[model samples]
Target chain A: MSQAATTIYVPRDTTTISLGADQVADMIQTSAANEQQRLNVVRNGSRGLYWLEPMLEIDTDRGRVAYGPVMPDDVDDFLATECWREQAGHPLYLGLTEDLPFLKNQQRLTFSKVGLIDPLSVDEYCHLGGFEGLRCALKLSPQETVSQVTDSGLRGRGGAAFPTGKKWQTVLDTRAEQKYIVCNADEGDAGTYADRMMMESDPFALIEGMTIAALAVGASIGYIYLREEYRLSEEVLNAAIRLASEHHFLGDNILDSDKSFSIEVRLGAGAYICGEETALLESLEGKRGMVRAKPPLPAIQGLWQQPTVINNVITLATIPTILAKGPDFYRNFGIGGSRGTMPFQLSGNIKQAGLVELAFGPPLATLLNEFGGGTANGREMKAVQVGGPLGAYLPSTLWHTQLDYEAFATVQAGIGHGGIIVFDDSVDMSEQARFAMEFCAIESCGKCTPCRIGSVRGVEVIDQLGQRDVEFEPDDPERLAQKVLLEDLCETMTLGSLCGLGGMTAFPVLSALKHFSEDFD
Target chain B: MITEMNSTEEHNNGWQASVKRILTELKDKPGALLPVLHAIQTEIGYVPGESVTLIAESLSLSRAEVHGVISFYTFFRSTRGGSHTLQICRSESCQAMGSRELESHAKQSLQIGFDQTTSAGDITLEAVYCLGNCACSPAMRIDHQVYGRVTAEKFDQLVSALRTNVIEVK
Candidate 1:
């Protein structure tokens, strides 16, 4: 470790620095150069403080001193005063980073390295203790490695919250000539950029995680099926793969262990349905994005009819931690069966909308109030959408529910993608319900009738309710009945659709209707 | 940069040149229903009809396809563009929080839309599908910038201040 006493942490979040972080970073570098100070500068991911970034942190006797909302012009004065060491007042100084209750109270696991390292630099990754999982996995027997993940209780972060280890173990147990590892980087969920941020900020972690998956599954080739919108992340991740290949972290004879694994990236054309495992596999094979029937699930016949282990970006990214920290360490953080931290994306109308990695079952109220700082506009909280478009809308009455996967589900909601979107009193639950149906209508892959045609009809019904047609008055018993019918229609879509694209929409729409019926009017 | 130009140059081969020449030949006629723009795009690569005249002469009709084709599909762009045409879906499904307004904002900011161009010519803006990211809705793409749940203000600032040169010229 370079014992460089002076290191600076600057946040590179766009929302935080309306003026931009690049200019501030350059200013810091230039000032550091003039002073002949050996400054270890890292363009860490956002600390989720959209209000304060380009936030500069300096090491001090008290703790890591913090300054933020820093602009390029202020860099000179920031250094000239050396006030950070003295705790002298500077307009940019937002106080010690660890003291911020928003960051202090929360647990960080999946996002441990975000906004803390150069996302592209392997050296920075190594310094921050990345690839430790890969190192551990290389030592463990394949079965032992699989067992470790199983013991960790880490579920998929990709909405379903499925057990990741079991999914990988199924592939390992299968006897097939060709097996594969596919990273579901197709993060189509609204109010969620955890996958994108991770890919852009720590591509190696994901790559390292995927490499381990390939080893455990007896697979040789790994594919990262990234959405086309994430072009920059694709470039960064590809570059990291090339670097990892050169360093023997990937490619033939990885880690000199006789295990050969090579990873490649495939871009998904604009298709929300492609986020589904089977649909994603189909798109990878050059077909129009459409869902495929499961049961001959992806684990058995996926990605060109090969037994493939498909995991979301965050799920695979957590592999290194599970291996490095031991299953018990990884499993001990969260409540009940939902162990380990979730990379929860705080977005939409929230005040401090950004990625937050916290233990499961944190009260949605606490998440919104303590960490998120409530809705951005400071209006009365009306409804909060947990998960994505298909996620349920938790009205203010249900705000006390714990945010664990099962707990949220108990209330007819799921923490799909761990994205919490806040809506103030101004939000109309009726309009939201209608929008959910409209969204499903546009996104359904036309593979299954229940999802395709049903979603379109669902939208029409919601529109009818919105327009206040003579058929159903707002407060009429028939209106409630119509809502129930729509909910039932959603249920059929949930059970019948090929994937979450159609399934998840029901979660939010139904919850909105059930919890906040008045808003629908 | 090399990859972009090589692909464009490769796409601009004899077939495309021949198509461009023919389109240039039929520059004028009443309504010139050659549908030359789409026909030329199909014949060559994309709608290379930079001007109304080029589209007019290409097919034996007037520049109707040039106008009609440009307006018909969301794909056509009159101005020269970067290698990738990143069309972000900005319809109602994506517009619950203002994607409808975002489309116009993106067009004005990008200095192009429906069939326009940015001064940089690196990206061409067009409306796309739910982009299959409706869960995240209000999504945008620029050869790969899949920003979701974006606001009009954020979109405007991102476009106005984007430093596309982040990628090194390989």
Candidate 2:
């Protein structure tokens, strides 16, 4: 590895700021030459404080000593006190990054080395224990590795929350010469960027995780179907892949362990529905992003009729952690069936709107009141939408409910995606309910008749309810007709749609109507 | 309808001027949906409905299709935009942290709708699908500024200081 003194600090993760990193990096390069200091600088991923990004750290006797959110104006001051370990005069310093409460609290199995090392540097990644999981996986039998993951109790973080090891084992059991590993990077759900943050910040982790998936499922090739708008992330991830292939982690004969695995990232033009596992496969095959009939699941016959192991970025990313920490260690973090901490992007009208990693089953109120720091406007919290648009709108009464798969289900809601959108009193419930229908209306892939037509009708029904004018009979038969239509629409959308886009929208819309019907009138 | 690219060699007035001339000539056409949109977007660098009446008369298609197509694609606009068209990808990939809620919040802050320009005429609010940068999901675009893994607070601070000089009818 290169160990020169002058440091370049470009944030590899989307969560990190590069607003001032460029100028600071330039100043560091110039200052080191001016001061006759030996320099080796490379841009690296975020440590994930977010509050203290574009952060520059200096290599010292201990490790990379930290200084952060450094601006162009701080260059001379920073150079004046070069070694941050001794005279770290910068206000951004919170001592070692390991001590930050936001970072320290995280169990960090998936994100273990995310913000620490140079993402593109294969040597740096190895030095910080990057391919250790793959090395360990290569040592074990494929079924044994699958068992290890199964015992680890890791579930998919891509909304469905399915067990990871079982999915791999299913692909392993299925007979196919051209088995594939597909990473669902088509993250369309709102309030979710954990996958993007991990991919951009630690591309190697995803590669390593996918490698593990390939090895466990006895697959050779993998594809990461990402959204089209992430151009910079594509460059960074591809660069990382090149670096990994140059090493023995990605391409043929990885680690020279008699295993040949290769990966590619395909860009989806722009389709929210493609985030679904089967729909993603359809899109990967150069078709429109639409859901497929599921008698034969992706595990059985997927991705051009080959058995496929499909997992979200977070689900695949979690493999390395489950491998290294041991199943028991990873499984000990969460309560009930939810056996690990989930990273949620707390957004919308919340006071503390950023990435939060919390164990499952914490009261929703605690996440909102303590962690989120309550609503953004200080308005009384009206309703909080958990798990993206398809998730339910929980009124304050249900705020005390624990945040877990089962707990949410008991309340007639599901954690479709771990995205919490807070709403203040000013948020019109009827409008939100209307939007839930409208979003479904626009995004439904038109595969199932109920979802395609029902969504459009849902929007119109809500519009009719919201409108003050349209006259009805003295008994208002239209209202009853609309109610019947809504129930039937939700039932059809719930059962008929191929994936969550149509399936989940019913929950939020129904919950809103059931809980906040006053808003509808 | 996908319009093929036209050559600029024969018309030295530049694409923007040609688009204006075309729009002016077609201003009085009734039901000017397909013709105005097709001609203006084809002639100008992009679709700009500066002369609505010219568009209405010349194209002879309904004003509705002209309006809907402009709004639907997310790229077309009725008003002139700032020097930079800062768009944040509000699709599912970027929505993890309340991108939808943040969308409404941002619109409220900018005093603009999905395709409307701000009162200051510095920026326009629009939605885009997956930046393919899901690694840093919850992203947004500010004109050409592509910001990923955006938090509500960061998005607010990003737009708060933006300044640009341009104007047109909404």
Candidate 3:
């Protein structure tokens, strides 16, 4: 065995960083240097098995071996130059990294190079089949590029599941003085970090994806409207953009072709309403993030009154691979109309909370049971909220529902951003229902009266329902009538509101009431 | 470690020149107001109420318009906070992992509500919806550093560490 033949990987993902990967990396480097060792310490992005971070991975002859949930104290023996090692004796060791069932079971398509490579290394990115999609896109006509994506059955991974090709084709066909491609990176959902992961881990992929979109839709300039909460992402993305520009992946005349495109990373202040594409555009234009009435979609007129394509970060990031491999190759992975894999986020009260990218059609039970390892406190799992706070709080009865958008819709649930937050048996469903209303009231943009007024009324009615024995004023409705009133308020918010902030806020509240009626009574 | 708020007032003395530097650097960029405001905040703690007029003039927006934009978002603060801004995540995932109890513990230990700084002027607590550290739930961010899997005891230790560190820095 060669003495200098080892590379150590420690994740630089936000979660891992918070968990002390930096300290672990520093300690390992110091220990290695003390032993006169020649080792490469690469800060890679996360593989999404967050529970095992600061997970330490080493390059062995067999493959990458994993050891982790490692503390700085446990890193000393790693650099003990005994000509390599035994992991079975180590308490933190978890055998070969890929062999772990959690990672082994996942169908990681977009996240292929996340924890394996330096996110900003354009050279490493190219070696791992990175910009092959953009190269492939460069050869095809813009119209043909759009056609191939349509054939791939790729829809927006950003909850709405809009047909990506249709959105692209609109911009392609539009007659415009200027055009824009805006990537919605404002990932505000509580349990969802897939966008952040993809951006942090393999940013080149997103750049490549956006470049392909630029080629497809004839957009010269792109803007990544990232949220301010993601400080790490801002740093990573800006560095990646500079590197991409230096390498000729971005800027005027890409790869010496007639095509020219550029990208800018713009940060959004804290407003959940800005996740809506129109509101995002308004924010990009330095206006308040209020939802606009839809008749002219963002594709028709967006970003300084020009043709635009506004896609979610994940949706755009998935573009490179689809073009690299073929429509059929990507299309073969998923079931029915929900083509391709989704990075399903499992968080909250689960034992093993992390990102699990799977082909569509897996039952929710699979994610909750096979991937999540059940409840964290060894308690019975009572409910799970699929999607964001706006999504439904599903009971165990609906566990059989597939992860597909259509399947979720059948059960009055939306797989919105593919985030499933688990709740244990001790949860008060009435409180959960009330929280949905309260959240709506807090985040409402006040563009419409129904959302602004109805949400506050929704909270009042739910509170009244919870305290059924209270003496009612002459004007106050009875507990049973209050329940009916809450339902009516939710309906108004769902139908009358302009965007998902007001429109879909009813999903969780109504679902909680429908599934856990006993909690209300 | 408890310091008076006078230091913040003293820091504000140079803010006019600081705001000018920020305005001169970023005012011409596309959609410049947000970036300019963010820069001023980074350089001078929060967006000082007076700087709004300077920003408005530079960006060619009315004072009311600039203030409207600032007030629209929870992140853009008009007043200067304590030495550090401590934002605890209150979203669903964190709540499910016992952030509510952690939040109450934080309030009790610090003797302050959300959005209110203590008399010491060393720590300011705020409630944020999410920090995207859901996997290791019950998360909080102090300045730009996000910490996860935080319990009541952990919160206490973190504050104590911050207190000691801030004293050493000053």
Candidate 4:
């Protein structure tokens, strides 16, 4: 038998690609060819460590040693020494890939196989316990499968935090000859990249999870409603779907069973409102992505007036782990109602920004100070916007807030999609507040007046507040009146808007006003 | 006004066949409107006003309905852009990283604001929310290629090279 060729890994994830991983990969290939080196070059997904991206790894007799932030010019020197195999005298060497403090400290459940496998290769995916969930799922009846998910205590990771199993039960209970499972990949949030990372790194997990969902609900067809901006994710997902189909993981009968399920990838035109479930359904049905009034909820009548199950990319991707291991094992990881680990995207002005997958009860301070290693420019971290454009801006005083959904809600904040965007002391909270309104105004679907018009008015009011002089007394009636008016506007938008786009828009504005009032002054 | 209408008419004359072909290929698919519009934009560089009537007829929808979808997405360009398009990020994360300064530099260098094309028709600058590379803040996309940690100097070099047609924008 021939000895297996040594593998050198370089990531093709979009963030890594943006940092010139493609050029670095090309250089390595050229250098290897020039030297006639008989090693295999494999393009893997990111390890969620964005700060150390273009992170290249080499398989050695000991383990996979790491080298990173590698530019094309550095490749010639790297190849000359062949120090990537061991932690030789190379300055870029970081010993074992998994031993890095940023990755070693966290728990990775949903993202276990991410950055560790060749995304396009089903063989590599299966070798690392990929399809075991679907294999176990196929053996159970639909009711039993739903119960397993229900027992796991898994909730929607797409900001709402609704119980995932209950949503599935509704679709399962509804009497329909045809039902649908839609994976919401419209990750339009500004500070979030977990959904995009999972889809790019381990797409088959999403596909497998959706297939398991179809099995649980007795659905025959599924769709992944993806955002338009994610061109790389679309390419990777389509390739993974095609491969899954050939392997009988998707389409027709499953692994010699009588069940039949098929999935398609549908791209959403740019619209933030579509991240709202009902509006997402509207867009998926080939109409304007306007928010639909609930009660004839999507599970009752959705996608051609049939039952449907819609879940976020993270929620669906985490299912494989829940099924592979038992529900108790998954449930044991978190605190309170929140179960399992979430992939937190630590971004913005931070020294070590990346995806940190941990259990639900970690204080925000730990993630910001420890894993994140404080502000990127060595300035003080003044505020952080958790969730997305619509989430609250938490000040340093509130940094001790735990990450559980209920805990975040107690402080009138939300752990929306687990994205925390840090800001340095140089940031102007007044400008950030104005941008919250502006973003809503730009992305609103125009179906609800409060969202469509109130956002525009909100922008005007914020600009007026900004124009007030700093010399004004704390109790100045004219300034106080404007503040009262702004509060009134926020109240109207929060209570009156049809969906979260406008309703939750007030969270950031009010949070900024409450926590960072000096910026407004 | 007469000259403007005549030139628009001439432009429509050039795109009619390709628009028809795209609509014909994608009309049968379910929820075909978005995909059809995307194909037209890809093939013709923009969704021309003249093609709206043809698309509406082919897809059995009203002209307003077709136009509504076209105008809804910031991605679908109604008028023709420059030979190359540069979309700069203005979202919160990027803002925290001096994107406001980058935006100003781009506008000053290109002599155009967001969504405006240069007089020479060589470059168009537009504002986008996020490119999903928040860790490497101050990101921008020229055509479909995303570049990150863009300083004023890097922006100048890229834009100048693109203007001179020294590097392929796509």
Candidate 5:
């Protein structure tokens, strides 16, 4: 086989694709050919530095030198320069890939392979030490495998922060003819895209992670309940499953042993409620995506009334590392109760919006200023919405809170899915608070009255509050009554909702009122 | 009851035959309602009025159950739309990127509201909560192709090209 002189790496990530990466890739191949050069092009996944997407990299003696945000139109002009290593006044040059402070500072445990490898090559995945986790797990007893995860202190990354090992143990102990392992890929959070990135980046890691879960819990069947909006992830996962099956990593009698596991990709309709596990189970049954009450948690009676294990994409994806390197290796990264690294997705008005996989101890200020570099519009920063739409809107005063679960909880905030959405001073807190209630009303499953009905009422109350002239009439009885009623409404929803939809919608509204009360006036 | 019967009668034999084919292919799978619904929507632009009763009967569900499932999710629409579906993200991430103005520009340019088709029947504008493209905010998806950081100028150009059939919507 004749080797190509040089290789060009262009990301096929969703964000890059939307920025016209495919067009750039096509142009690079043609332009290099015209220069009498035999250049190989490989479509890899994004490094999560989205602003520089279509971030083209080339192999050099120093390492993978990067340059980017390259349009198809710029490909010929840059190739014509013939001074790639020397920098030669090219406008898109970003220096070496590893030297970028945004990536160099990251503690990336789960996202290690994301932008570096061709996503679908099973040989490359294995060759780079991929399936060692499953191979290690096969030798241990099911209880032992579960114990390893428990000792690692890994909690569910899917917002609730429940211990993943405890949930798996509940399913493992329960006797049943069949058990199910479901990976919740219904990441509907407005400002988060880590789950989508991981699935599109390294599909095999998820497959391997789920296989380990099935082995630990004695589940024969697995399903990845992916959201419908992620059309690209669907394609990547289907192809990955096919490839893994061919290698005997899946299906009956895997790897010359008496083990069997298979995963099916099930699509969720546009219901945000399905992100809630019980509602997800209901939707998987081909019914309306409604929430189920919790007398019997999903661990004991789930799916078709059988034992089940449901975990978020990050929680499952982290499993392979824990099993491969032992619990201590994974446990040493985090602080307090929250173990391992969290893939914090930074977006919105932030100048350097991207994913930062760091251990759970950095203050919110570090992530916002150091990695994010404040708002993109060069304005003063105002509020930061942590978690998702349901999360609280924090003011500058709260920026010192560390990224730990317990630490964020102290400030009425959360590390839910590790999403940090920055906003400029132009943001109207009252409007954001109103939108929180409106979003809940739109997405609530109607399983409980407070979430279903209270959200609508919350919207109306906020509208009336907005109309009141607080400057002229500080003693207006009607305005005072409405403010009390708004607080009461938030209280009722937090106490009475069946799921997080109602329970947490008040977080943003209440926080906005407490911190940015002037906006309400 | 009479209207229901009339609507079913209006459905051609070809529609019924394809619906039957979809049911036969997916009926045996566990929790097969969603896959069946997706297949039907894929075959036709939207879930027709008459197919609910047929789906209910085939899947051993009540007619109310079928209707409830369709109405519960925003993705499933009851009526057919234009050649292309333009879903603008209305969630916070996009909102922070000035999608509020883009929302206005899109509605004015097409003379349509969310879930409504344009007057010329070339586009259907819809509101989506999020498309998982938050890093590149102010995102909109036309069919499967998502466009990011869309300014009002960019929006106008895409709309004109779409009207002229420059890109395949499907």
Candidate 6:
């Protein structure tokens, strides 16, 4: 009798690899070879259920059977067992990969095929409705393509929340012999891995999106400004680009058409300020990552004084689906002005921390409780910082706010980068506030006085406040003076700073002060 | 101790040669300073101060310009690092998961603070913002290998193992 072939799935995602997934994969491969089992191992992306990472899935005649947090020592027993045939008696077996509540609940439009496909395979990407967008894009005029995006109501996912279609239209209107499409993959924001996940898992999607952008804006060359820490992303993206180019999806005369586009990956050298669009442009030009003054926005005079279309990785990755499906189909998923699905990353002290892609306008409480599964330690949740370091720290009282951009704005918060970092009751909001100032100081480009000098002063003022023991009374002179001074400093930094680096530093500091008043004591 | 000192000097000489070779190879590339700096640090473990002059002269830039670029980034170091680097994420996400306690444990165990090398030259501790493994809080990287859900005990075990050279980290 002929033996049937067995397929084993392992994640090559960074988070999974960090938990010794590679070692587990090696063991599985070696053990299968030694046992002479007809096994094929494929390294796929993370399923976003991190608690069960090193999560190996085996394709059986019944379905895909899952095993989790698998160690190297368990490989022998795993291979010996008939657990793949049935999930009845195995301790590690998790039946059916998709049935997991954490994954099945998510509305994964952008991240639909992340964990399902082999990341680097162009054929796999094509099979999963990848190039249909580019094919659709090739037939449309540049104005029509821009209008499609405008009709979709996609905003910048990189925290600015600017309309993406308008930015593209501006670049399209500009007359330049050589324009560029820059994908901002410099995801330095804490508690955010969506950009990295998109780059590492569905890299070709980002390339396809950028190619679509290139076709839309009439730009021939592009660059992905990637963070330095994402070494794996760099490798995967470059390989995907090469594969796409080889398949005639990129480079000269793409897909036997007049359109041509090429992309190069540029690594940022450990500067958080480089995540800023202007600073990123400066870093790309081999200069200090100082924030450039605006008016001549990057869309107008960027990358050697030529027009450029710069969009975040998620923003670009969302383009393919929008182009393939109609604009209304994409727009129907979201609420209010923030149309479309967002890959909200839950981290910090969360119990079931991972990427949760959902349509906007879900109550903040639902994400914190339902998606995150509350604090990992079962401690009382103190605060949740929506967005990155510069985002506001909201107390539990404000948890009812919706995840829409305008809704967050009403509460003096911005959903910057869609990263929610939960903090338990054990957290000291004062220390967090101080860290905010310190981070700004360390990452400040020193272009503006309010950010460079004011951040240092903000730290000193917060330290002085920590020393004081006065209650939160309006008439308490010493306390009142310090509060006023801190507010003034925040105001200066917010208004006087050259870029968002200085402008948004006040968010965390001021929000912590406002919400966690007891922490100040 | 004397042999160790002599070996350190010999290592410095080798680093100089490697830096020169790297500069020669990457000098002509467009916007090569950052890449050149990255290559030097990758090869020598840290960017030495004297090498800044070498880089500036090769790239036809002022030493101040080179120094500004190097110092602007936290990853580049002016002095030599220890044999292994242990970078603990100090960002709010990791902080929420008792990284502060783990950081204290790491410092006490190594008898060194962040950005400091231990007296034994075994490990250099540094603070990174985020490792993109936020799902696994208290994430740390020992050299290029990232370890997640790192507890005080797990950190200590890794440190001792690294000090003893019992197992290669990767």
lDDT of 4 by residue, B1-170 (tens): 44754566676557877887898898998788888888888888999987787888888999999898888778888898998889998988888889999999999988999989999888889888887888889899898788888999999988877766744543
* DockQ score of each predicted structure, in the order shown: 0.08, 0.09, 0.73, 0.65, 0.82, 0.65
Model 3 lDDT at residue A310: 95
DockQ head-to-head 1 vs 5, winner: 5
lDDT of 2 by residue, A95-191 (tens): 6566655566656667777767777778877887878888889898999999999998888999999998888889999987799999998777776
Model 5: per-residue Cα lDDT over B69-166, one tens digit each: 99998888788888889999999989999999999999998888998998777799999989999999999999988888889998898888887773
TM-score of each: 0.79, 0.77, 0.96, 0.96, 0.97, 0.94
Residue pair clashes in candidate 6: none
Segments of candidate 2 deviating more than 4 angstroms: A1-10, A17-42, A54-93, A468-484, B1-86, B89-126, B129-139, B142-144, B148-170
**What proportion of the true contacts does each candidate reproduce?**
0.04, 0.11, 0.80, 0.60, 0.82, 0.77
**Stretch of 10 with least lDDT, candidate 4 chain B:** B1-10
The residue-by-residue lDDT of candidate 5 on A1-521, one tens digit each, is 37547777899978899988999888777776776666778899899998888798888888898887787777777677652443736789888899999999999888888999899988888887899999999999999999999999999998999999999999999999999999999999989999999999999899999999999999999999999999999999999999999999998887777999999999998999999999999999998999999959889999989999999999999999999999999999989998989999999999999999999999999999999998899999999999999999999999999999999999988889989999999999999999999999999888799999999999999999898544537667887898899999999999999889999998999999999988887
lDDT of 4 by residue, A181-298 (tens): 9999999899899999899999999999999999999998998999888889999999999999899998888888888888888888778888999988888877788898877878
A191, model 6: CA deviation in Å? Answer: 0.9
Candidates 1 and 4, the one with greater lDDT: 4
Name the TM-score of candidate 3.
Answer: 0.96
lDDT winner among the candidates?
A: 5
Which runs in model 4 stand beyond 4 Å of their true positions?
A1-4, A468-471, B1-14, B166-170
In the predicted model 3, the residue pairs found to clash are none
Kindly list the per-residue Cα lDDT of model 3 for residues A291-391, writing each as its tens digit.
Answer: 88886988989998899999998888888888989899889998988999999999999999999999899999999999999999999999999999889
Q: What is model 1's native contact fraction?
A: 0.04
- Interface Cα RMSD for candidate 4? 1.0
- Which run of 10 residues does model 2 chain A get worst, by summed lDDT? A1-10
lDDT of 4 at A280: 89
Clashes of each: 26, 52, 0, 0, 0, 0
Give the distance in Å from residue A422's predicted Cα in candidate 2 to where it truly belongs: 2.3
Residue B128 in model 6: lDDT: 89
